[model samples]
Target: MASRARGLNEDGGFVKWDWNKNKYIWVSKDEINKPSKPGHSKYAWKDGNKVAARRPSFKVPVKKACRQPLQVANKHGKMKTPSPKKPSRRPVHHKADFIVPGYDHGYDDGYDEVDEKENYPRNEKYNAREGKIPPPPELHSGHTTILSVMSNRLIHVNAALTFWRQGPNEYISYVIRTEDDAATVDTLPALVNCFKNKTPVSKQLSLGACFELLPTLKKLLSSKFEDYVKTSLDTLRTMLRFWWNDLIAHRNQSFSGDLQQSRSVAGIYMSAIAMTDIITKLCKRKDGIAKKAEIVGTLLAQL
Candidate 1:
């Protein structure tokens, strides 16, 4: 060990067995900021370390960092890139006495089956009450959702009354003139309401509403607007179905015991007769209405 140390510390061409150790001490050129002749006893590797000698060129600026040499003696060492700190995991908490409303397991109330009418407009009241807006209309066929909560709330034949009261034929005229897809969809909820009943009033009004629709209906058959034509045809077909269903409802009620008390049989009979005449008149024309006479006849037969 002493010989090895001497050989490293010496700076002579020939080995000196006992040349003064102090005078012959070797200073490493790689040593940074090192003296010209540092002694072997005051060695840079005093602790058996091979630290790179710091030179004038190796003076790191105050702003810069000097990286330490790796310690090879230790089997495991800190890596340049640290092992990722273990994630600061969220601590789990036990459930307290407070109940989470929707989190309740297997609760099956009427909320699961809310039959939201597809074309029903988003009423502000309903939105507040329900806590959600209905999706916008899927089609631009001039049909829109009901404009009012009252319109939305109307059920059975009342929706059909709203349809007529709003003047559907005139609404159709405006929609056709404007040629707006949104306007076309706007008319649908009312037209749709025309078929939303099995009542006597709905049946009678369904026929008149078809007649009211005839102007817009005829224009649609020959007009260039495909979506308008489709909406008109569908509306006409649906009204006929409503008429037939109302007739059937009337038929069930015609000879019933309550007919004597309310005495609405004559009105129902007149509505059926008038529907047949108007439909037969429509059959005389070369329009699509005449083409659908078979369905009309079937509807009349059920009456």
Candidate 2:
């Protein structure tokens, strides 16, 4: 028979834990080796004083994993399946100005998603629904010119600043007449107004406001200060175009790589905006070509 009770002591004696004494006590090895009583032998055991064979057990069944599909919210707050198709290079017809993913040149430019959505063109039909005049025919077409793209981008930036209520107060006085005027400008039509014969409200525009209205500011300042205005405008446009191309290149190079590059792109974009303001001030002072050249050099070096 096998010993099934207690453990062997250092002295080679059988011992078991004593709850009352709080220590191990000696036990009789012969008594522990005795067979269990016949009445308690219900479970089959191979030898006396051995634990009965373990009862067979069945495992609980596992259920298969279930996953839900992804969904996106439309402008109307309705949930719909995300479209796999890329946004058309042309204008999209929609009831509201909705921000569609994969629209900004189909690559991340390091600007936050908010900036991407804010920079998009205003939906033409959405404007008409609000009882406002639609923009020019060319602006609504599939193929938009580089000048138009730049102008539209500036307008949208102003509109975004207006939406966030961070735009210069001078903008309100210049654009707003009655209290009922629309909060945001109709972009394309507003761009057209920049080239019109009417003078921009120079007195109403501040440095910060001038940065927001680049195309119109060129018109405004060129009228009063012609010396550096034209050259500065050309330089600024070239700088913006180069910066945009650089962003596209960086996006291609580092799409799946380091995020630090993305952050740098965002910083450069903001720096360009700051440079625009600096150039505006320079134009206001009629700063000579030498100073403009130096500033342009510095701006290019940072890129």
Candidate 3:
């Protein structure tokens, strides 16, 4: 029979197993006399309680192996097509309309001989009926014989002083006159008049008397004699100047009067006026030696 009161150290409180009586005994050092037999029940012997067995060792499940994220290729849109270029059109060439006959390429081959032969007789007939003289080959076409005459007159007047011839038995005579009358009367006429009159005492004197008196007079005049001659000549020139002015005034008035009545008269008057004015100006200088002589003598006499 198992003793109910028997204790095992592993149990919480006093408890016993019926088959293990000797293991359940409460042994003490003071009770050595009540010792159990050796090897009688070895399994039944108890000193201290055994610890509870630990739970079995186990491995935790490993995390599922992660897969790497997949890489996707990028998509591109379609490429654009290039437009085609157009070609340029060229300009058309044009041919000339009126083609002249008898023109040999670029050369003149005397092919117009027939035309000339047909026209020549008609031209001659027309010209003959008009009574026009054929021009002389040697003559100048633009200038007339009148121009030649005018040019020759200019040359003659330029040489008039030295080369002019006097009538036989003519003598040098001095005449004094006012400026207004000089233009209409010729110098030769006045000079002839002075000789005929025999008015100047100097002219009538004998050669001996002239010789005797001239030296003394010349001495008194000295260089001034030249001035005296010039003074007398100035008086003559004044006459010429007034004459020219009158002539020009007359021509201009005549031309203007004739302009409405007759163009030919007006043209003739204008031409004549132009010719005279040009000739007068050419022969007479504004500051002439004669004028200077007159001025000098007057100034000296005043001094």
What lDDT does each candidate get? 0.47, 0.45, 0.35
Query: Per-residue CA lDDT of candidate 3, range 1-303, in tens?
Result: 876774554333333443444356444444445565444232321332221111111222237742211111111233456878776674222222112345333335545433433454655534433444445656766478878766755554433322223421122211111121122123334433433455462244232321222222222222334444333344333322323343345456666774233343333233333333323432344445534444434332322
Clashing pairs in 3: 179-238, 179-239
How do the residues 185-247 of candidate 1 rate in per-residue lDDT, one tens digit apiece?
445656666566544434344344354444555455454554554555566566656555555
State the TM-score for model 2. Answer: 0.18
RMSD of each: 22.5, 32.5, 38.3
Model 3: per-residue Cα lDDT at residue 244: 38
Show model 1 residue runs off by greater than 4 Å. Answer: 1-190, 193-237, 243-246, 256-269
Question: Residue pairs in steric clash, candidate 2?
Answer: none
Ten-residue region with minimum lDDT total, candidate 3 = 67-76
Which scores better on lDDT, 1 or 3?
A: 1
How many residue pairs clash in each candidate at the backbone level?
Answer: 17, 0, 2
